[model samples]
Target: MGFILLINFTQQGDSDDPQSAAVEQFVIGENKVILTMNIDQQVTIERAGQGWRLLPAQRLSNQLIEQMMRTWQQVQGQVLDIEIDRSQQSGLFISMVLADQPNIQLFTLYLLAEQVVVHNHQLDRYFSLPLPMFNQLIPTGLLINQS
Candidate 1:
């Protein structure tokens, strides 16, 4: 069997222009709602102390999730799937796949606080997850499925 590489829209090299090439296409394991580009560039989105941050592709920390869940008053049922939507100008977009039964809809935005604000879009109100915590929440099952 043959495999393909995926490129995210947000990642830019030395050039000013954004990387437009789709090296390969893949969806996060299991949940079909989250789509990932460029497996090499897969960064987990999570929440940090009083802010958001990004975690490199690797093992997810459950402790972070526990902290975020307590701070943000979020539960597993509230989050469907978290994905890196590199198409936006804010560095990244944490697409919140709502737990809509039967059909999952990508609604709301878990965006970086620097380039965006909570009220800028409707998604802001729901999941204002910090990048670090978001990244820690990366589902291992999903990562394995991508393989």
Candidate 2:
């Protein structure tokens, strides 16, 4: 039961210098498709055999699929230290299944009227992203009652 800390560092442009690009690092719940997918309040995409499909069999264009997958795969957020009760918070729950992992990574997204934050309960870490981006992150028209 040891865990490896995963870090993602993307170099910008064609420069070999690391400083040229901004580095964004976050944990992959044991440094890990995501062998599977993320389960949200209204979104659910899972990989079966060699293909991926949307839950309840929703018809999504290939382009939209690619866009969503890309966003989830490369999703990065600024880590924050905050305390909140999971039971009391009215937030969206996202469960991420990583490759070759027996456990499911649990997360909660608190979409406040003013700000949006994702809490990783496993790591006790909170992440904040631009409110506008959150809308784009989940994709519009995907949720039935999303505002």
Q: Where does model 2 exceed 4 Å of error?
A: 1-24, 27-31, 48-51
Question: lDDT for each of the candidates?
Answer: 0.34, 0.66
Per-residue CA lDDT of model 2 for 5-80, tens digit only, reads 2222332334565442334445343246566555565677776665567776666665676677666667777665
Cα displacement (Å) at residue 26, model 1: 30
TM-score of each: 0.26, 0.69
Q: Quote model 2's TM-score.
A: 0.69
Model 1 ranges with Cα > 4 A deviation: 1-60, 69-88, 107-147
| Highest-scoring model, lDDT | 2
lDDT (Cα, 0-100) at 35 in candidate 1: 19
True lDDT of residue 48, candidate 1: 51
- Backbone clash total, candidate 2: 0
lDDT score, residue 60, model 1? 40
